[model samples]
Target: MTATTVRAVLFDTFGTVVDWRSGIASAFDTVAARHSSRLDSVHLADAWRRRYAPSMQRITSGDRPYTDLDTLHRENLTSVLAEFELPFETSEADVYDLVHAWHELAPWPDSVPGLHALKAQYTIGPLSNGHTALLLEMAKSAGLPWDLIIGSDLTQAYKPDPAAYLRPAAILGLAPAEVMLVAAHNDDLRAARDSGLATAFVARPLEHGSDQSIDLEAESDWDVVADDIVHLAELLHPRLAR
Candidate 1:
């Protein structure tokens, strides 16, 4: 598909537009502070995120009915707390607060600016595994200027599932080829492409913290490969170039 054929640009919000690792780590620190315990917040963040895919795998594999991200996160929090062996007992309220942290993630430095730039021309919004409520809260918290949010709650499917990719395109009343999936994960882009959506790869080298090793570069020749969201805007909307 040509550049002009694309009408909407949908982003993978977690690592692509927001810094989940730092945001989650900071949230964990806040929780630990409330308990007056010094926990490895960074490691806790990693552990929590490590459970992300596996939690969804159950539903994606049809082993369980579809569950929203909030419930899955709350469930994963229980497992992570057990694995961490927190010194203090966490009440349900505390668990809910921790789960809510996912909705308070900070955007990448370039995210807001780049989104504004792209918004001048194309439709922009999150097409994420996050639930609609989570994505809406995150967009508001991070100053994300999205046209709309299409979360897993709406589609009832997660990434790598063809439904997740195609459903959003249909919801927007656009053909799959008219939509572009911008992501930091090569696998996600591959899924979008296989589902007939155009793809853009935005490298987020620090997404998994300083030790991140994967998705530092485009593994395949996507429609666009950018250093960051700002670069994505420049690549897609060339008139923004100085």
Candidate 2:
């Protein structure tokens, strides 16, 4: 994939740009404080995220219809709550607010600036499983300067799915090869590659808060691999150097 061939970059939002674990842990702590329980916030956050993949798979396999990620998040949160057995009871409002934390997540220090760099040369926005409303709120919350959002909401199918990759190319009026998927997860990059998009892998070592067992680095020599988003931009758009 030549750098010259790429006209747009679609990103995976959660671990790729935002620190979901840290934000979710902080939210859990805040909620725990509300209920006056000394919950281990990080563990709860991990437990909640542990449900993410299987939750999506349920919908992807046609057993459940395509549901937006925000609803999936709420359902996962409710189920994780039962699994964790929160030490104290919380109201429905509290649970909704807890699920809403995804919308309030903080970006990695480089995310916005790196995007600013890339946006100079390419159409850029999320190609994540996150709902459009959720990604929009996150962009507003974190000042992400997106050209436009393209996600599972657009195709009603999550990434790793061919449609999720191809539909964005169609929407942008570009060939799949003309778009690049910038993500921290190798699996995501692999899917993008299979769908004919260029792939750039960026490391997000703390995405799972020190216990991250996977995606610690690029598994394949994708079109590009960089230490982080900023480096990715510099690598792809070397003119940014000046």
Candidate 3:
């Protein structure tokens, strides 16, 4: 947890760095426009995200072989589409495009600036459940200045599982304690902390939506807490904040 001991700073991507809901909804709107149809984009975005954890649980539980997040998202989109019963017929290409939207998600306003600040001081990249290809595409699209990518595909594990946190630190040639995880989700931070990594909680109250009720604040006494990614950068590198 000591500042000097930390060597690399990893982040949780989806809700932490990018506004996934808004980005996904915008993508849906574009597709709906393509078909000359009306779709409840926001509702679909929320519904699709709701299935994320459960879809990963099966793989984490060893019920199924570990699958990359892109495939899982595509499969989940099928069910989400079925549940919504879209007014217009959707083709396989449309399904693929909708799933690809995750890669194009826009970062939060402070994400780029804050990440630039951190990258100047430490090795920085994403340690997310997203697979390498997806995370790489997202980083390129979002201009995330990551030094390297450590994804589930590379580790064959997902977050909350100790391996997900531990593997990345090892890959970076650092001990778990030397790698800090910065995330908006309290549970994600808790898991990182439990796996011997230092944790920083960055609040993203609107990650879900304006009415989002959960993860409004740090649920536990994490190593550091801040209002946003820029604030996290400020806390970690006080000299730069000035």
Candidate 4:
């Protein structure tokens, strides 16, 4: 699809627009500090994140009943805590606060400015596995500037499902070709493309952290490969402005 024909740009949250690993790790560090424990927050964060795909896969494969991101996070948190053998002295309120930490994640430095630029030309929104409330809170916290919030909650299905990509196009009152999926993950872009939507890849090589090796590069052909969101906006500005 030509840039001028696209009516909206849908983004994958998490490592795409927000730095979930760093944000969650920082929050975990605070919890560790409170407990006066020498917990390895970085390792804890990595372990927790490693659970993300498998948890979602369980839902997708019907191995486990469907659950939202918040529920999944809590379940994983319980497992992580158990594995770490950490004391369970924290109140339920504290646990809730920590779970909500995902809602307050910070955006990548280029996210805000680049989104603003793209928003000027086309509608911009998140197409994330995050629940609606979670995405809304994150948008507010990270200054995401989305024209709308679209999450897996709406379709009760996560990404890689064609429905997840197409649902947002329907919500935006546009054809699949009229929407573009901009993300850091190649799999996400492939899903969008398979659903008939245009795709843009914005690399975030450090998203998995310094020691992690996943998602180091794009694995498929995308409509565009950008260094970051700001550079993506620059690439799209001419075609979208028309």
Model 2 poorest ten-residue lDDT run: 150-159
Better of 1 and 2 by TM-score: 1
Tens-digit per-residue lDDT, 110-152, candidate 1: 9999999999989999989998999999989999999999889
Off-target runs (Cα >4 Å) in candidate 2 are: none
The per-model lDDT (C-alpha) reads: 0.91, 0.89, 0.92, 0.85
As for TM-score, the candidate ahead, 1 or 3, is: 3
lDDT, residue 231, candidate 1: 89
**lDDT score, candidate 1, position 237:** 77
Clashes of each: 0, 0, 0, 0
The regions of model 4 sitting more than 4 angstroms off are 239-242
- Candidate 1 C-alpha error for residue 4, in Å: 0.6
lDDT of 1: 0.91
Residue-wise C-alpha lDDT for candidate 4, range 109-169, written one tens digit per residue: 9999889889898899998999899999998999989998877888778878788888788
* lDDT for 66 (candidate 2): 92
**Candidate scoring better on TM-score of 2 and 4:** 2
Between which residue pairs do clashes occur in model 2?
none
List of clashing residue pairs for candidate 4: none
lDDT of 3 by residue, 1-242 (tens): 77788999999999999999999999899889999987889999999999999999898898989999999999999899889888899988888889999988999999999999888899999989999999999999999999999889999998788999999999988999999999999999989998999999999999988999999999999999988888888898897693
